[model samples]
Target: MTASPEQIEIALESKAWPFQEAQKLVERLKKFGNPKGYVLFETGYGPSGLPHIGTFGEVLRTTMVRHAFEFISDVPTRLIAFSDDMDGFRKVPGNLPNQDMLQQHLGLPLTQVPDPFGTHESFAHHNNDRLCKFLDSFGFDYEFKSATEAYKSGEMDVTLLCMLEHYDKIMRVILPTLGEERQKTYSPFLPICPRTGRVLQVPILERDLAAGTVTYRDEETGKLVEVPVTGGHCKAQWKADWAMRWVALGVDYEMAGKDLIESVKLSSAIARILGAQPPEGFNYELFLDENGQKISKSKGNGLSMEDWLRYGTPESLALYMFQSPRKAKKLYFDVIPKAVDDYLTSLAAFPEQEGKEKYGNPVWHIHSGTPPREELPVSFSLLLNLVSASNAHDKETLWGYISAYAPDIRAEDHPLLDKLVEYALVYYEDFVKPTKKYRAPTATEIAALEDLIRELEALPEDAAAGEFQTAVFSVGKAHHYENLRDWFRALYEILLGQQQGPRMGSFIALYGRDKTIDLIRKAIENPRV
Candidate 1:
């Protein structure tokens, strides 16, 4: 069958991970269309505290799928970044304001709890506002929904009644999965204690389905109170609420971390019993730290979205989110520079790439099929080290090294580099400046260093960065250094007097071939004491 140009584009995109997910979504839509005239994709958040990198991840990945969906189908789509602010606040985050004030509100709904920081109405509101702010900064297009608002407005009332109607059936599905003690008095409904304003999971004394109310005996006072099953009077257990949300919102697709596999399965079953088919979903593995442990807020070990943006760009972070999500990967401060490099590499090659390879480029996904065409004059890591070597205090000073290395480069040519210079300066101050080191080369290392200096002297002053780079590589091979690392170390320690620096070729090109040779000779003749 002959395919349309749009179909060909989508088919190319279909080869990628998230786009592949979107293509699957299109296929499913053909099987069963949403009667609502649009496909809904949801990614949920728990606003117990501040949003993290993982929060950015889910929304970004879902948006990629949405972008891919647009390439394939004409169906309208919406992404719901729903926040579960209705959930109880069980723990006080060490990072938030007024820790002493939070303890009094523990076990109440997060939206009902006061914001210790005094910024928003509550902790949940503060976090939700922050989530919107961050996503807006990245220019994300999404619909933000608050669970508290959704429930308080009686939007989930029908689903709430459905849960009440099938309370016995829902319990049968949930009880066996629990420990014996938890099974004794557990009910699917968690009512906000009328006296104390805390969401309580107490024994369900009875349900008046016709009246749309549930009577639950409070554990604290042993008094049974009746409240409407909806309108924020009642909240379901997480598994039950997940199903209820699906049925209420008509979510067609959602993705969650691999840790929620059981939760997703249980929610799917409950959703079926509640009279709506569960949304199709992908359970991806969670991000890990350097030690392969899960990145945790309490541990304070994972890189924050703020941290990533302070030192990295939104595009690099977007590319990081676009990588193999089902496979667990380490996300840390050290990973940022490489992610930046990989993003640049894809941009440089994007013009020539075709077919699936073109669609598969992370840049293509990062930019939603329109990646930046202009490439940076030098890689970010190279620029960072160059900044260190030359004491570049601003863009002009940094451009000095950049212009020297690539003489044709103009300050007006690269706008991305200008933004990057700001990030690199802040990054250097925070991560690099404290550990700055300078050491003379060992007597054994000096001979190889001198040989490299002679090679640099022979290279023409007009040599290109790549040509000078080749000369540096040849010198390393000739001297039988273990590898380039050893040779580069010699250059850094003996000349720049640091354990590591930028690529010697580019550094030499910018630092001047004559000055480089002169410095090496001076070091050899009068070794640093």
Candidate 2:
């Protein structure tokens, strides 16, 4: 049964983290006439390179909140995703080919840096465009704001002035935050000059808003550096500017990675001094690599959203994102299939009344609110082969086949079959496509292969399920199989031609008698020498 929309809302509200910081922001907003009926969420992007899964997680959670609000309230909700393309290049991502180009473009606005791929005009634009495509694919309704565009429109001038007015306070916060070495060389902010391709040192000067010019004396050399600022093109110092921008933009809530918690806290203090409301903030943990290290573009350990989409469906990806962001976790390719299965199960658990609502249904809301089950789909490669070979069209038939052979999947009450099927299709299209041409197996792996086949053949075809499982185990023992570990290793080598596959009985059952036999025969015939 599916859940009703009201129930889903209740479920979501029930799961909402009691964000003390957000509650404070909400209370402060009440002073501004309760703002009538709108929830605003902001997500920022640095156009350094390919947007990782972490980026998707941030926006996706924001979208979840927006939906929850729409479900529970009569007022509209808006989410804005801003790309910081105007920021200067700190370091070129490792994936890029030319390190020399980055050096040439160092200290220049990202908008001016040349694209390593030569596909886009600038590195920042390339990544920003890629991120935009990813967001659209996921159906996130977000207004895209480019830092370049925001600055050019004079929208940030007031915020810039606010930072300059409190420059001493900003410097105090910034200097102590940086290491002593960096503090010696660093200015409060580095404003990029497009014409000169240099970071123009902006000093304290009388603001001439009428002429759009600022005059300042260089702190280091005591030399005067005066420049005419273009209406759309002045830069702000990193920390001070960041706080000012949030208040100026009226962001209600934002989520940051664990690394930025300290920085955002300092920004909050700046917001109070400026009498501007700071956005509600949550710090989510990072997505780690299979090696258990933080996934980073610089380290070349991060996976792109596009790459992950190739291996799993968007919703399955959403399930991955829904996994506890507070805990440090590793997400490997092997984990996606189970995520799909779990999502489907969650969807199935909803009562029918909740399913009828198109948006904001209580069942879905609850499902969204909870953490995904620890179990994920069997494996993408295994599922691809099963789907490729199966005659079944719907999830129910496929799962029915799975339940027939796998005792773990309870036939009567499992709700996630539809969700599993959706994930299967995506897995096939994305990850499976590249592997379609590979033959099943060869003679090099035939000993382990033959042993598994011989054992399966020895089991009585008409035997009861438990009895069949017992016979299969007995055969492994007779053959002196080290454990289920060695047995599965042999099975996977024979079936999928790899080191692993889905649970054996469930996989065979899902593939059906004819297809399973055919695959085994193919493996025997084409054994890799």
Candidate 3:
């Protein structure tokens, strides 16, 4: 069950999340060999807004480990995802239809956000439903729990009593960490006021279960208040309360983003004091934007899972999830097409025996998980242009091109090629928006391209690679272009209406003389000016 040296090396090289810790856990499990105890994994949904890609990424990786454990041993594993709808709304995330509506739902259970989408009763429910759909799309089978349901069932009553019993211990940990006096009197837990979207100090003053109303008070101004407490725990203070609940619920493993690493560390200490087994932890980094900013639902700065799917299949997205989440990495919207193509190519080339031997199983783990290799057969744009220009939409044409040009690939590998074609189709659909046609090149640009085309044509048949490179460079020098890069840029601009693209010579060689010339002519006619 322990990972082989090659597996450990790959994990380290890839910097997979909990890279070292996962190895350790695997080794531990191998030693224990399916202990007569439950293996549990936990994830949470804040119900703040549309759950972002990061949320899916966390759960998917957790599922990977859970499956790994199941495959390696006979232990039964439980993956539980809790929707923390009981948590109070902190702010209205961007892309929401109504900010005012969210404010009105403040201080209320998240299950009550007035659904801006109008399909669900509340914003919290809307997001929770979306998360469920997303999880289902990714093939995760999990036990779902709602905070509202857990609280009403008195599942947390003992935990709540425990918190009350250790109120001082909670204060000691919370107050020093909070840095605000107002927070001192605040119960570690508070309910959201449905009318204001503000955190109420305590939503329940005196409960009239039969009437479904509770007497309440405003913490800030000592104003008497009342609100309906139909069901559910009002709110659990995040971080501190979250830590307590994890221990109370017996979470065996949970993956989290880097931002919460310190909080989880502190929570683990608290869990120990409460005589609860702290869950094994995996800390991961966030995906960033093209400008190197963190992608966040609150920030609204990056692509959503839905956005990605426009150009990528669920499997491609899953491969993206398989990437190590240890380092903060940016996912540029423009770069995804090529990345998806590369992932498909890698999947095609995946070493099946290597995967089985390394993981100690015959499962299709590599195909089912992991990002494709970094190198791609060609740039996505180039492939799309070839396919479009040839009007060859069939899988055979696609496979033929791969077999002919990408010698590293084989036609016998049609299964992986089919995946690539599917991925390419999705990419074309998502990113190929209608734009103005390419414009005709000016006299000087046309003259420049013609001269370079002549020089390339005049190269001796079976010319050395170096000689071919020099012939192209000579055109740039004659045209007063500073370098070969300048010549290529001008050629691309004239031919493709872009400053640069895939390597021109390699592109031409792959597509053949007639097809390349025809495509270049087409590009000239439909210049994307």
Which prediction has the highest lDDT against the true structure? Answer: 1
The parts of candidate 1 lying over 4 Å away from their true place are 1-14, 298-300, 436-439, 482-485, 492-502, 518-529
Q: Lowest summed-lDDT stretch of 10 residues in model 2?
A: 354-363
The residue pairs found clashing in candidate 1 are: none
Candidate 3, residue 79: the lDDT equals 88
Q: What is the lDDT of residue 329 in candidate 2?
A: 74
Clashes of 3: 16
User: Could you tell me the C-alpha RMSD of candidate 1 in Å?
Assistant: 2.6
* TM-score of model 3 (CA atoms): 0.74
Off by over 4 Å in 2: 1-9, 12-33, 184-189, 201-223, 228-233, 351-501, 514-529
TM-score of 2: 0.72
* Local distance difference test, candidate 1: 0.83
Residues 481-520, model 2: lDDT tens digits: 6776777666555555455556555555455544566666
Q: Write the per-residue lDDT of candidate 1 for residues 412-502, one digit (tens) a residue.
A: 7777877777777777777776776656667766777677777777779867777778888887888777777878777777665567677
Model 1 misses residue 22 by how many Å? 0.8
**Total backbone collisions for each predicted model:** 0, 30, 16
RMSD of each: 2.6, 7.3, 6.3
Candidate 3, superposed: residue stretches over 4 Å from native:
1-19, 26-36, 191-199, 202-234, 352-381, 385-490, 503-506, 509-512, 518-529
